[model samples]
Target: MTAGIGHPMETQGSGAPGAGGGAIGLDELDLSIVHALQIQPRAPWTLVGSVLEIDPVTAARRWARLRDVGAAWVDGYLSPAQEDMTWAQLEIAVNGARLMDVVRTLCDDAGVLSLKQTSGSRDLVALVQARDVDTLAEYVSERVCRVPGVQGARVHVITATPFEGSQWRLRSLDAGQRERLRQFDETRPAPGTPVTAEPLRPVERRIAVALGTDGRMPLAALAREVDASVATTRRALGRLLNSGRLALRCNLARPLTGWPVSAMYFASVPAEHLDATATALRTLPELRFCTMTAGPHNLFLDVWLRTLHDVHALEAHISRELGHLRLRVEERAVILRTFKHVGRVLDRHGHSVRSVPINTWK
Candidate 1:
């Protein structure tokens, strides 16, 4: 959902990411600033500074420094507005030689939220979103399946996302600061809650898209970007933010993070144990996104571990403690590289370079 985030500066400078393509080495303050924005991406400098015990100017400057290096970024993408919207995980088999070409073509498409090359049975894995079942079916049949080098695609519709990335944060923030900075809690909607499906207003659409790349853009700058009065823009923004139709998150480059390795687990939990199994997983700090999918494997887990050895340890830990859940780890894959994630294009080292706006409405 979201990663390390920073507030936008009054001015931005262009440059290559952190030196020599090595570890970002985010220090205490840097991590704290990221945690502040992660908790609330659009938090003002004054609020962040007060809570983090730093000057407003310092907070803004630090955020700019991190952003310039592509160490951290804010991202905004689709939120499930209604029940009809479908989320799918695509395990794609590609012809090896045409890998880059397939990635180039699919990255530009709005529905492909995230696509990455992996080390396993599938050449690629893509997280796709669409308006409805028919829309998703059409996209797969006409667009994805027909792609030149696509050997095959197995689609797993995400039935229930018990946990997601937005709810995560660095342990850098202390209890008091964490408690005080709770403006927006990115909690998942309770089951059976009525979701709104109201259409986005013209100005709202423009504003939402503009924030995808820079979620922490200043209100004044944001107003100018959308070409509307500050008052009009603010009103629209307030509605959109409180509306629960928009998903805004900040992302950090995983390679620079201590937990650099990314892995996926395909597991199945019997109907009776699904809820308890998901609840048990919430205790795992390494778990990123855990979803219930309609496939042979009912649950899919995306995790970040410090090293490859940790993978086996994690699985063993699950098996030892949660044997009663009847969860079976069916298939596993190590993500070699992620070319594009949630619309942001990343460098080889995983630093975000640019973004292709999500075009879900169309």
Candidate 2:
């Protein structure tokens, strides 16, 4: 999950409401709409309207406004198949003079999933993905380590991802609204199942590319883009989604939600207790990302909190509850700014301004 560190009302252009400003205030209805999508990203506008007690057209219009201003967006990408994919985190200590340049170059690389300028011993922290362990090793040893900044790097290969961004929710809606949205939700595949590494057909690739830009695109529009009949397109989409190959996510500007602080923790946990520890961590509402990695620090967590002070409270709580897990905290870093999140290019305020589709095969 990505969070911004900007003020709620900050803006760049005219001060007019809904204009291109640094911050956009969201009303109760707007928040409900976002929450509805968060629960079921591709839910029909009519269904969303019913859940939020608004007209279907009004619901669509409101979402259009948010999407046009870059306050919210929906993205679809190929999910990592356990048998064929690998995820890793990199901590790079770059030369001071070339930090910005190096960051820009890494952000433009398709393999780098998220890049952030952080406050800690390291200058930058990156989440990257590869086809396999060997590919990840070569990418780190050759491509990333050989960057012009001329700095040493530390790599942590993720071995098991117990929880990730897709499982995160804004939790702003009421219980009734959430229950209404859940009817359209799809069940996520269990971890460790081997998904067939099938190559996408040309038409399927085209559809995926289109959805990458707007996961909530209308079915008719998607069919037109792929030059296929609506029924055929819908069937293909269902197959892709059910095949455990594609994932849809609804992302919103962090400033709008009032939870702006983002923090990452690196710690070590015994192998035997990793599963229980990870499962417990996933129960926290603030937990955004959690994984077991192959490194000195075996566990990593990314969380979003209401304020910086809450970080201490959270750490203390974790220590008290799961102390028996023998989690050894190694390093902690606050994400000062995020340049890219998932597959979308974000602005300083964490709004998705543009999308650079993540095609792992490319």
Candidate 3:
């Protein structure tokens, strides 16, 4: 959940170190810890230690070190599927010289959840969310388009996201270890849950925001964040989670993983075939996020590959396999850098360093 919008896939391809700062390499233990969280973001250290063959205290200390350096973290998302809201992706062309300045300013807004510099006709791509269609339209017109360095923007409103970031995982752990942590899997809303209308409860919204900062925060700390009693906080949290009002997932610095390359593809599919195509696309392990969007291109796909060459290889496989729909890829581009992801400000290498509170619920 880029604070406000739909969840973009968090895949970075393998490559050399990035510029802007030195890279922090992760050893076998760090990778194992990340894989543990990918399976269950809220798992207890004892469980993780048992799975990885380490003392619980040592496991906690190593994770803390990774968290401190922005190498890994867990965050919360407000489910777009369950919430009545507008989700859109923005392609903004900015004044070249002031690109960094413009991104810094936009990062302060909760509505712009994910921002990326790309290698294509558009300089920036953003995932945005708002309370309703009118609010989204107004914000794009008055707030986003009018930003000092913005030249123009094209909006692609998201219709349905069948697959997203939280579903992706690291493959470091063996099957035996993964099965041990699989018992805690309850990350998504149960099927057929009703959509929630606007105007979330005050304390519930506060709890969601606090999770965006630290997904593993204790119940007592959450109560403090919202100034409510621990029992009250626990009850609200249970309701939010059980009802699918809130979403949580573990995230790590993508660049540090073996896959560091990121790419985006925009394509068109017949309205009737959209659902079938997305269902077929979900099985692709490289898929980061896939959505049926309301725009010239009905399909938007983001993925990470092992190498830059794999970009075209995956695209070719899609066109060849789904040719019955005459699915044409209108445009494709790779990400140059990500300035902000969801609510976290990232370094060029995609590590979270600072967080701007996600204010979408307000």
Candidate 4:
């Protein structure tokens, strides 16, 4: 049971680590550097240089800056079933005084991938990836539960995830706006209207691929892959990120960490009352994901349960809280396998980052 005091707010940022050194603010060059790296983390400097049309040394230095800020990183995503592993998310409630201490231990766990200190009923949320279901149970039942002053720890096994990550869609930004993007290097601007339904181009697609692979490639290296100049590549990335098209961050699946149960809760609310109902569900401590979709059921909540009992309790709690509205439970389909992610089909899309393949770099 997650026990906390404050209401949960809708706030999310890139989960990937940022450059730790506060040497200087970001600029267009840094963004370009990130864009190129995400597509091809291991790409050669010579190839990247060609993409940015700059020499190798310049590209390397820019990449170093991005890394220093913890803005981006690259790592392999080992499949859970194939790798003989199990994963889950741990939602914990702790006294405010011991929050940091608990978080420190949680972060130190070898199995833990990502940890977030959040508001609402739970003080800390963690994504744990382990070798097997047994490992997941031990990590939560023994290691995490042993923390001092811990009220409770909830673990949820992730059966399947239809979508995750920051949802980086670079389909917005026209050529001109993209050109202007090279001027600013920050990850995102203040909140604005969502940008969808726009067309994407070749360079943008390549940049997205590059960032998908590395998120921290040197400008020269990135340029070589896309066959563009460092100046041009940097501008394109800046535009993509600042405009919220491409997100450069680490996406560690919760299953990788150990909490594995995946369930969706549907609440029936009348049209006029939808807003309030959604607001209430958002405040729920166990609800990690919520959405207002187009269907007979307007409100949907995605939750990860630590144990079988918690699963029943979660549903019961929702029913008790919103029973007046006639809530419904729609079980989410288990993820037997994941063939594609972030637009990259592991088997098919891995080879080509662009819609049309061009051998210009070679």
The alpha-carbon lDDT assigned to residue 238 of candidate 1 equals 68
lDDT of each: 0.77, 0.77, 0.80, 0.49
Candidate 1, 6-124: lDDT as tens digits: 21221122223462464455667877888788888877888889998889999999988778777788877656433436899999999999999999999888778889898878999
**Cα lDDT tens digits for candidate 4, 115-223:** 5554345566565566567767876878788888677887766543223333221122235433443333433333673544354456766876555445556678888
Q: What TM-score against the true fold does each predicted structure earn?
A: 0.87, 0.86, 0.89, 0.45
Which tens-of-lDDT digit does each residue in 1-362 have in candidate 3? 01211122333233334333555667778778888988778888999999999999989998997788787888886765564568898999999998988998888888887899999899999998888888989989999998899998999999988788878877678899999998664333456655454466788889888888888887788799999998788767766777766777788777676667889999998998887888778777778788778888998899877678878888888887778877888899999988888788888777787877577765
Candidate 1, superposed: residue stretches over 4 Å from native = 1-24, 80-84, 184-202, 227-229
- The worst-scoring run of ten residues by lDDT in candidate 1 lies at 2-11
> How many clashes in each structure?
4, 4, 9, 59
**Top-TM-score structure, candidate number:** 3
What TM-score, to 2 decimals, does candidate 3 have? 0.89
Ranking by TM-score, best first?
3, 1, 2, 4
TM-score comparison, 2 vs 4, better candidate? 2
Clashing pairs in 3: 2-113, 2-342, 12-259, 12-260, 13-259, 13-260, 13-261, 14-259, 14-260
Candidate 3 structure lDDT: 0.80
Candidate 2 C-alpha lDDT tens digits along 213-330: 8998888999998899988787677767767567778887766666678888888888998988887887777787887889889988898877898777777677767788887667
Error of 4 at 236 (Å): 34
